[model samples]
Every structure is written in C-alpha cells, then in structure tokens.
Target: MLTSSNANKKRTPNRLSQHLDVLLFSRTRLEGIKQRRAMWTDKQRGIRLSQHELLCKNSCGYYGNPAWQGFCSKCWRERVRPAEARRLDTRESGEVTTPTFSKFEEKKNMEKGRRINTMRRLFWGGPSPPKQPSDSQMNALKAFQKLEPGDFTGFLKTLRSPSCQRLQSRCTAFLNTMEAYHALQVQKQSDLVQDFYQSFAEYFTSFSEAELTRTMEHVEKLIMTRLHKWVFCHDSCDDEQKDLTLQRRIRSLNWVTPQMLSVPFPEMQSTITGDPFLPAITAIIEMDAKRAPQDKLVCVSKCSQHVFEALSTSNSEPANADDFLSALVYVVLKANPPRLHSNMQYVIRFGLPQSLMAGESGYYFTNLSCAVAFIEKLDGRSLNLSPEEFEGYMRRGRAPAAASGVQAAACETRHLLDELMSRQERLDHGVDALNVQLQTWVQAVHAQIDQATSQLALVQEEVTDISLSASSSTSSDSAEIEHLILTDEHVGSPDTDC
Candidate 1:
C-alpha cells in the first residue's frame, strides 16, 4: 500500500509538472499575441496619422493626377463620387441656352476668334500667319469715297449743244490724230499712263501727294480697263463700239480735266484757246521761232508769260534749238493733258519733247546729234540757220518705224514665252495630279492586302483550332477503343475467375 501510494505521488508530480509547463507555455503565447496586437495597433495609428497629414479626407495625397494612385478606394470617399455637387450647380443654373448672333455680330466674332487663334498659334510656335493689308489695298480704300459719288455715264450724254460745235470739232480732230497714231504705234495703256505722268507734272500739282496717290488709284481702278480696251481692240466704225468708247472717254475726260488743269483755268470744253486750238499750238511755236521774243506772236495762257519772262532774262542761255524747243513743249503739255493717247499726249509728251530737249548732254540726252546756229532770241540763245536746215533737222526726228518694229518684236517674244510657260505649268500640274492619284491607289492596294492578310490569319487560326479539336477527339476515341479491347480480353481469358 505504501509503495502504491508513492508511485501515485510520483505520477501525480509528473502530470502536475507537465500541466504547469503547458499553462506557462499558454500564458507566454497569450502575452506574445497581446504584445504583437499592441504593436500592430501602434503601427496602424502611425500610418493613420501620416495619412491624415498628407491626404484630403479619406483620400491619398495625390489628386487630379493621371496616375492610378490619384485615387485610393479604401482611403477615399472621393473614389465613388455621387455627382451631387456637379448636378446641384447645373440644376440651380436652370436650363442650358445657346446664344444666336446677327450677320455683323457673327462676322465680328469670327474675326475676334481668328485673331485669338492666330495669337495662340504664334505663342505656340506655329506656321506662317495671315497676310496683312498692302499699300495698294490702302490706296484703294482712300479713293473708294471719291469714286462712289459719280454716275458719270448719265452726265456725259448732255454735251451736244450747237454752241459747243467749235470745241467739238477740235475734239474730233484730236480723236482722229489718236486713231491714226494708234494705227501707227501699237501703244499699251499701261505705258501710256507713265507717259501721261511725264507729259504733265501739273497732274500732281493740284492735289497733295497722298490725295494724288489716291487719285491715281482711282484712275487705275476706273479708267485703266476702258483705256486698255481702247488701246488694244478699238473699232469705232462699229457704232456699238463707238458709243461705248465715246461714253467711257467722255467720263474719263470729265474726271481728268480738273486734275490736269493749271490753277487759274476752269474746264477744258470752255478753254480760252479755241477754234483751231489743237493744231494752232505747233504752228504758233514755228511762228515764234521765225520772229524775235518781243515780237513773238504765240497765243498762250496769261501764266505762260512767266516762262517767256524767264526765257527773255540774260541769266541763262539755251545752248541749241532743242533747248529753245523744250520751253514750247513744257508749255503745251502744261496747257492741256490731251485726251489723245498718241496724237496730242504722245506728240507733246514723247515725240516733239524728245526732239526738242535731246542734245549731246551728260545724263538724259546721252547719245544724240546737235544742230547748231548763232543768234539771240527768247531764252537768250537761238539758232540762226535757214528755215530749210531747221525744217530738215526737225523732220529728221526719231524714226517712228524703228520704234514700232522693236515694240512689235518684243510683244511677240513675250507672248510666245507666256504661252510656253503656261503649257509647261499645265503639264507639271498634270504630272503632280497623276502622282497623287498613283500614291493614293497604291495605299488603297496596301490596305486591301493588309485586310486580306488579317482575314487569312484568322482563317488559319480557325483551321488550326479545328485541326487540334479533331486530333483530340481522335485520341479520345482511340483510348476508349483500346480500353474496351482490354476489357474484352480480360472477360475472354480462360482463367478469368482469378
């Protein structure tokens, strides 16, 4: 009994020791779990504090960024926006409206938008910008007001009075001269415009420089086309053509006369010099050359006395007959800017002036011969040669035929060159168009090929899949057949019972 009790004690102590160790282990595990939990809580608190510092309520620090971290689902209510803020603002603003504009307003807005877009493009470093207004366009604008006021065609048909017959006869003579000259020299109106400017510098004297420029612009706009037509393709025998020419010329004359006049003069139709006025100018100068300055019988304007006075003075002496003739040429051109392109303007402006002013000199009259004489007249110097020598010298002026020949040759050459250039341009345009079409066709073909290739690839993939599926089915069938055969063999064996 004592031994058994001692054995029980030993067993008891061993079991208790085992239980104590288990309890101690359990307590230690519980303490470790508690400590780990506390540490996890502390780490979470620090993370939360950092998040609170960096983020907007329930959000990561980043916002409005394109990256995925711009929003965090767990950390932000912003991740699932209800659209309420946007909806409320829109709702409070009432229904949406579209504004409309008048044509002028639309144009203004369009211009404003264009300017804004242009400025923005400049800021960004874009391509070349729109063209600004040029000098010619501004000149046109300045002249537009003056041009707007006239219905000149209406006013010109009222000039058929019997009292105006003498003036009308002179006009007829001037027109005849112009027609004859045009039939002689095929002058262009553009060349004639330049000639007109040279013929009478007084055209510019009436207006300020700016106003003159505008006036010139007006002439180019209004008068140039009619003048050009008259120069190139006039046919006055055709009454229709004659009427049109008359009307245009009359209108042009009306506009031009006021501008071409010397200060004291009024209108051209009521000129003080009349009857045989147009032809009288040349004859008067010839008569003057025949007589002395005091006895010179030239019927000139009152203002023309100034030129005579200057000529009669002892300070300057003209070297040759040409210089003496220059005074006359200046006087004639100043007196009237003739309606005739070739007759009056050409004769006074180019023909007679060149013959009169030209001599062997430094700049202008560079290569010309001289007719010499020895006498004293108006302008202090004069030629004392016989009328025959003077007449021969005057008659032996710049040959019209040579000038016409050169001009015709030049016009023909220019026309031919223009035709060739035009043909070449057409061919180049054709080639470029063909090239664009070829490239477009090739690109279309390539696209078709790419599409076909993709279709083929899809078909091939489908075929492959079909092939694999067939192979898989075949293998399954073969395995099933083999298993069935083996089962049959087992069933059919002699020692099948075992």
Candidate 2:
C-alpha cells in the first residue's frame, strides 16, 4: 500500500503538468488568432479610409463634400455668413478704436466684401440675406425698404421696375382672384388671367409699346414663377399623367434615328468632328430644369439658335425654317428630354400673350410646341418606316446589337456604319469604272482581230488566182523555148563546119 501510494503521487504531478501545458497551448493559439484577426480588420479599415478620403479643395487640410462645394463645413459656414454679421461682431467687440485715415479704407474694404459675398450667395447655393429677397413675393414686399422719406428718384425707379410694390400689389390681387376661382371650382381661370393682363396694360398706359411689352413680360415672369409650384404638374391636373405617358412613349422610341425622322442631319465621319448639335441637345435637356414660363421659353430659343447654327454650318446654303424645325424635332428625339409635354403646356398656358403671339421668340416657341405635338402622335407611318421594321427596332430597344459600343467612346454604331457605307460606295464606283474600261479594251482587241482575218483572206485569194494562171501557160512556153535553143546550137556547131 505504501509503494502504491508513492507511484500515485508521482503520476498526479505529471498529469497536472500535462493538463497545464494543454491549457497554455490552447490559450496561446486563441491569442494568436485574435491578433491576426485584429490586424486584418485594421488593414481593411485603412484601405477604406484611403480610398474615400477627399481633402478640402480650399486647402483647409480637412475633409470636404460636394454639398459644400468641395469645402469643409467650417469653410462653408464662413462663406455663407452675411457681411452684416461681421459688422455686428466688430461693433459688439465693445472697444472703440482711435480714428485714423486707414479707417475709411477699412470700411470700404468691408463694403466690397459684403457686396461680393451677397452676390455669391445670391447666385450660388446658400441662405438668402436680408437685402436680397429669395422669394418673388418677398422681393415685391421689400422693394420699398431701401427708400428714404421723399426720395422721389428711388420711388420712380421702383415704380418703373418689375419688382415695384405697385406691381406686387396688382399680382397679389390677381393671385387672390385665382385662389377665389380655385375655391369656387371655376374652370375660367384662363379668362381671369387674360382680364388681369389687360388691367396690367391699363396701369402702364403711358409707357411706349416696346416698354409696355417688356414690362408685361417681366410681370408674367413674376406671376408665373410664383404660380409654377402651385399649378405645374399638379396631381389634380392631367399634366402629371401626360408627363408619365410621354416619358414612357419616349423610352419606347429610344431606338429612333435621324433617318427615321427624315431630319437631314449631316453625315459625320467621326464623332470627334465637333458635336455641332451638342449645345442644342443640351438646351433641350435644360428645358426641364427651369420653373417659370419665360425661362422655359428662353431655353427653347437657345435650343433653336443652337440647332440653326449647326444646320447653317453643315450646309452650303443658309438653313431654311423647315430645316430648322426638322432639326429641332431630331434634337428632341435624341435628347428625349423629360417632362416635355408638361413644359410645353406650361409655357403655352402661362407664357405672356404678347411674347407668345409675336416676334422670333414667339416663332421659336411655337415651333418647339409643334415638334412636341408631332412627337406625341409619331408612329411608323410618321417616320416613313414599315410597321414591322419599327416594331423590330422597338423590340431591340436603345442598346441594339447594331449600335453597341463602349460607353467611353461616345461614338454611336450608326456613325461607324455610315462611314463603312461611304467607303463601300467609293469602292463600288472604282470597280464599276474598272469594269467599263476592261470592256472597252476587250472590244477594241476584237475589232482588230476581225480586220486581220479579212486581210489574210484577201491575200490568199490573190495567190490562188496567180497560181491558176501560171499553170495554164507553163507547157507551151517551155516547148517553144527549147526549139529555139536547138536551132541556135546547130548553127554554131564546129562538126557541122568540118
């Protein structure tokens, strides 16, 4: 029993040591795995940070974002703060400095910065300052704020301007009339609008025709700019439904081509040959970006001008009105601009009657409306294509196999096809010319061979006639010559003399 106890005690220490070693090994492995996992996580985090890091464009040594125009948040705050805030800050410093000549220069600098920053905030994205009214209605209310008592010059200027308090009052009155009509569920808003314009003209009776026309235009802009949000593409109206239908129609017709529309677009060899239609297309696209009727009309005019410029540059003769309209149609198709129908209706309904009914601006706007109308009713017959072909193209959609290319190239497959067609035409022409020349040469050789055969036949006939005549006279002539020679020899013989 004592020996057994000694052996058991010895085995107990060995077993404990083995258990401790296994536990230590397992812990060490777990720690190593955790360390490796932590290293990998940190590496991934560093890669993500490096990939997405954007330094402030103002060199402020901080991160930036597009919402702040590539500026850090701190820089954006400084940029958007009004200059008056800076003045207030200086005044609140509570210590009056000694007056110096440089004080005048400092004040001038402050005013300059104030004007610049105000202009910047007005044009760029930022909160509006007190002096600049961001809203059209607000502008009208504040127009008189800059005036002093008995400032006749300022009053007259304000009265003459579109932002005049008088015009705003008239607009507000008209707006109330519209709201009353809306509340009464009246459908004669058009008549009310026309009556309002007539009253507007009465208010400016002393102005010249041109000045009145211009003022009316500005008034239309102010009224429409305010009315646009309330009325444009409203759910209560059919404009939204029309917009959806037109968008879907345009999407389905994405495979349309210039040829399909008979647009007579210039056949360009390379896309890099200056995209003449780019400006026109861009203008057409920007039509959706504007809110007011006048602004949209201006976009239409710009598109028209760009289209005309492209047409004039491409053709030897000046582009006619028909060509301009056709090119405009093609531009609309290519751009497939969104909300085209709604925009056209908006301009037609709310645009100034004087502007829409007269001048080149009116003419261009009319043509654009016509182009949209044509597009709305377009079909295979309109494009002069068979229904089957049109449907086939529609089925193939915009990314047709015949027109596929890398997006970066910016060249359409149709342009490449057009170039290939031209090259093939030149090749065919050369082949035709070569075939004509070969036929002519072959004919000339054949004629020369016929002449040579006739000459050979004539020479053979002459030789046959000479041979027949010689055969007929040969025997008699030979016999007579032999007799004559014998007689002469007998007379001259020496034996006969002896």
Candidate 3:
C-alpha cells in the first residue's frame, strides 16, 4: 500500500507538468495571433494617415483625392456637385454670380479679356476706360453727336456717324448672342458664325447683293477682329501651349537638313547654292502677315502650288498626294511661320464652311495643318535617323556661334569651296562631252577601215580569177598545136615510106 501511494504521487506530478505545457502553448499561440493582427492594423493606419496628410485638405475623415478639388470624392460627387449645379442654374436664370475658374482657366480668360480690350482701345483710337479721349476719339465723338454727320470717307468716321448707329447697335446685339453661345459651351462655333453672316445679309435687305456683301465683309472684319481673342481656343488648354512648345522645338530643329527629312525632290538634295523650295517657304511665311482667313488660305494655296511645281519639275510622273504632303512638310519646317497656332485657329473660327471645309482651299489648308502637326511631332523615328544623330544635330543647334572673325573666315572658305565644286562640275560636263565625241569618231573610223578592207579583198579575188582563166586557155591551145604537129609528122613519114 505504501509503494502504490508513492507511484500515484509520481504519476500526478507528471500529469500536472504535461497539462501545464499544453496551457502555455495555447496562450503563446493566442498572444502571437493578437500581435500579428495588431501589426496589420497599425500598418493599415499608417497608409491611411499618409493618404490623409497629402490628399485631405478639410480633414473630412474619409479617403479622397486632390482631383476632387480638396473634398472627399464621395462628398464632392454627392453634396458639393449638387450645390454647384444649383448655383449654375441660378446664375443662368439672370442672378448675378461670380464665376469660380481654376487658376489656368482664370489666366486664360484674363488674357482673352485683355486682347478684346486692346481691340476696343484701337477701335476707339484712345486710351482704355477712365482716361481722356485721344484726338482720334474726340473727332469721332464730335461726329457722333452731330445730327447730320457728313460724308464718311474713312472707316473710323463712318463708325461714329448717326447713320451707322444701326450697324453699331446690331454688332453689339450680335456680340451678346455669341457670348450666350459661348457660355452655353456650344461645340459648333463655326456653324454659329456662319448663321450670323447669313442673318446679316437678310437684315440688310435694303442694299443690293453686291453692296450687302461688301458691308457684310466690313461687319465681319470689325466683329471678328474684336472677337478673335475671346473665341480663339477658349476652352482648349493645349492650343497656345502646343504653339509655344512647337516653336521651341522647331527652333531647336533649325539645324535639320532637307536630306534628313527625305525630301522627294532630287534637285533639293543636290543643290548647295540655293534651295528649290524657297518660294514655297516664302509663301508659307507670308501667311502670318495676313489677318483674314481667306487671305491666309490664299497664301497656303500659293505655297502648295510652288511645292507642286517643284515636285513636277523634279519627277517625270505626276506628283501623288503623299509626295505633295511630304514636300509640304519640308516647306513648313523650313519656313517655321510665325503665330502658326493663332492663324490656324482664326481660320477655323471664321472661315466659310464651303471654302474652308470642301474646296481646293480646304485641301491645301488641311495639308498645311498636317504639315504643322508633323513638324511638332518630328523626332528621330519620324525622320528615320538614329537617336544619336538627331541628338547630335540638336546639340549643335543649341551650341553658341563662334567668334565673328572665325565665322567670316569660315564663310570665305565655304564660298571658295562652292566655287571650286562648281568649276569641277563644269569641267566634268566638258569631259563627258569630249568622251562622247571621241567614241563617235572612233566608231566612224572603224566603219571606214572595214569598208576599205572589204573592197581590197574583192579586187584581189577578181585579179586571181582572171589570171587562172587566161593560163588555162593558153595550156589548151598548146596541147592542140602539139597534136597537130604529131599528126603532120605521121603523114610526112607515111609519104616517105610510100
């Protein structure tokens, strides 16, 4: 009984030890899981804190982005958007509301406003508001007050005349109409401008078609000249920026050669003294000088014609559309016309649909636009040149020029080299001519020698035949005479024997 009790006590200690180990293992696992879960929660909180620090401006307690204008995305879409819609509706109903434009949009609108004011200043021929009138404006104001404003030989005088008040009033009404369209975010501004022109003709029915047409042109010039700044690329963010960017890019690419662009004309490749497309380049540059869309289009057409003429002279076959476009691209790059973006936008805004969209002028202008686009995007891949070569050329363009004295010396050397090359080319042509003449003379001499040899051989053959014939005849006669003599001898012998 004492031994059994001792054994039971030993078993109890072992059982207690095993049970304690299982409890410890379970507690450690639970602690480990809790630690892992806490770490995951802390990591997620860190991410959320970082996001909130950068994106949340109002501390809205929810995840949002700066793109939603500093408000949480959900709040912006739900609460703020509804409020904005209500405000817009109220403003549209003729309640005065201050516009809230983004920084970029505000700047754009301010610049446009400044442009329009400049035109107004010019039209008034005086300082802007809050200033005394200039001499020109004083004269116009005096004319305006007169009951019977006399003959207006000048446009400025005509604008101030009482008889022309109707015109001024109508222009103001038309401007208001255009402003309404602009506010409404109309897409087809060109079509709207067209409708305005058609309405102008109908409104001025008192004048003949020719007179009305002339008046309409005047009205158009007056309005669009003032309106251009407001409407030109109004909402488009990229238009002016693209122009400036392209201007810089093209300036960098001034070092680019016609060969690099793979101009289709061979003469353009070979000629060193002058480029064949100089006239086309000049015409393209002249496009900037004109203000009217039609005049600018005319310049484009003239440039295209020059390109076509050059292409035709260079190649035997007629130039295809692709060839024309390629040549035009080369011309535009070389010309690098000024204010290219403004000119294109003006044409797009004011040009007649029939003329600018469908006719020959339209085709030429489209090609010009394409050329400008191509120039803007020009790169090594576009020109089929290695990136290294393109970068090297661009670097050279960016490099500063040498000293004047060195440049002068270099110019002199280039002139001398050109003269030498020209003289060499002339000498080459002379040598080629001489070689052709020499070949002709050699061929004629060979022909004559052959003829003389054939004649000599025929004479020798005739002489030999005549000699053989005479010798044969002589031999036959000799044989016959010998036979006769033998016969005579035989007869004489027979007589003697008898």
Looking at candidate 1, what is the lDDT of residue 190? 25
Best by TM-score: 2
Greater lDDT among 1 and 2 belongs to: 2
Please name the candidate that would achieve the greatest lDDT relative to the true structure. Answer: 2
Write one digit per residue (lDDT tens) for candidate 2, span 70-115. 5544565457544544565567655976446477458657866775
Q: lDDT (0-100) at residue 461 of candidate 3?
A: 99
Deviating ranges (above 4 Å) for candidate 1: 1-400, 495-498
Query: What's the TM-score of each model vs. the native?
Result: 0.20, 0.47, 0.42
Q: Write the per-residue lDDT of candidate 1 for residues 1-498, one digit (tens) a residue.
A: 999999998999899999999999999999999999976654333101121322223343331111112222222223432343344445654775523446435645665567455433322223333234355534433333244223333212221344323323433443344445564433332233333433222323445554544334333323332333344333422434443443343232222111111112222233232212233344334422211111111222222344344344412443232332333333343233222222212222122122222221111111100100010111101222345643443354424233453575577668678989999999999999999999999999999999999999999999999999999999999999999999999888877765
Off by over 4 Å in 2: 1-157, 160-167, 176-187, 270-274, 397-498
Ranking by lDDT: 2, 3, 1
> Clashes per prediction?
3, 0, 0
Judge candidate 2 at residue 121 and give its lDDT: 38
True-structure Cα RMSD, model 3: 21.3
lDDT of 1 at 191: 32
Q: Which 10 consecutive residues of model 2 have the lowest summed lDDT?
A: 44-53
